[model samples]
Target: MRQPDIEIYLKDGDQQAVTDWLNATIGPCTPWRRQGQTFKCQAANGAPVTWLPNAVGKWHSLFIESERTPWEDDPAFARAAFAALGVEIRCAPGGWQEEDGIDAADRWIKINGEGEQEFIWRTQ
Candidate 1:
């Protein structure tokens, strides 16, 4: 089976906020580990999930394997998840962003709250 794509972007540089959002959004699961500043976790299905901290900007990103992800097929759940985190999700792109003017097989989401963030999931 092909791996699904799901990405989450965060606005601020607070790692705890991201972890809180994940725990609240995804439910109580395994605890994420801190590798330096980034957080990594494994889903119940054993899919590797990671939350990367910002290096150049305040934006943070999350990469998850959507095939076994809890909210892959449900955008509402994802949106609600973010909403619960106190962040508003503006655009969850079905494909690539028009402003980027790039072509790719990845899916993405655009967020506008606190700080700008994005999530990209590779479909191909």
Candidate 2:
């Protein structure tokens, strides 16, 4: 199956923070199991997805990956989760072609709070 172009970015929290939020809300939709250094879950299509606590290159980032589904499969699920946590967010739809001719993120989520923080998703 071809995955949709979807990705999620978190700007205000670390992996544990995001994980706790996910597990708290919509966890019933899909539960996660902690692996050695990451949390693992399966998409509705049975494709594996992972959430890394300490992403090497990116600090305090949580990523979602699945072979069968785009990260945007259920954005509302995430929005609701964030809302439940009282976090304000602004999302920018991805798929923008930059002036540099480089492919940009498929989606960009900006957290309205202290510190300059945002998350982006790139899908090809």
Candidate 3:
């Protein structure tokens, strides 16, 4: 099957980095769930959110949309994506960061802190 769009978000709401990534990849998925959207239910992570997954994996997501996704941000999913990816994403005073690095044995996206985020691509 074809790959789906990858998405990112800035707490700052600049959308520049997300836009750049969008241009290079499949496409960006607009947030169907926003701050004011109707409360569908409390997420597994306990975040009050709206919307549900329209499809399964293939795209990178900044937030959790479904239990099928394997992201550490979605703590209660099947297994911690961190466990599968072997990368630990942590949050600190600065921002979201990752130091464990993506594991060669698995696929992971680590969150190191809350500010000044970065990407550690597979090649690097």
Please, what are the lDDT tens digits per residue for candidate 2 over residues 1-124? 2334334444444545555665553342257787787677754555455666435334233444443432343354336535655454444443344663543444455544452344554533
Q: What is the lDDT of residue 118 in candidate 2?
A: 47
Shift of residue 102 alpha carbon in model 2, Å: 3.1
lDDT of 1 at 46: 69
Q: Show where candidate 3 strays beyond 4 Å.
A: 1-16, 19-28, 31-62, 70-124
Residues 1-124 of candidate 1 have per-residue lDDT tens digits of 2336666555563656755665665554478888997778876566677777773265566667656665643244347546666654433444344685544334455544554445654433
TM-score of each: 0.57, 0.44, 0.21
Worst lDDT window (10 residues) for model 1? 88-97
Rank candidates, lDDT, best first.
Answer: 1, 2, 3
The top-ranked prediction according to TM-score is: 1
What is the C-alpha lDDT profile of model 3 across 51-116, one tens digit per residue? Answer: 322212322234434332222333222123223333333221121226633352133333423423
Candidate 3 has its poorest 10 consecutive residues by lDDT at 1-10
- Residue 65, candidate 1: alpha-carbon lDDT: 64
Candidate 1, which segments miss by more than 4 Å at Cα?
A: 1-3, 24-27, 35-37, 73-78, 88-92, 95-124
What is the RMSD of candidate 1? Answer: 6.4
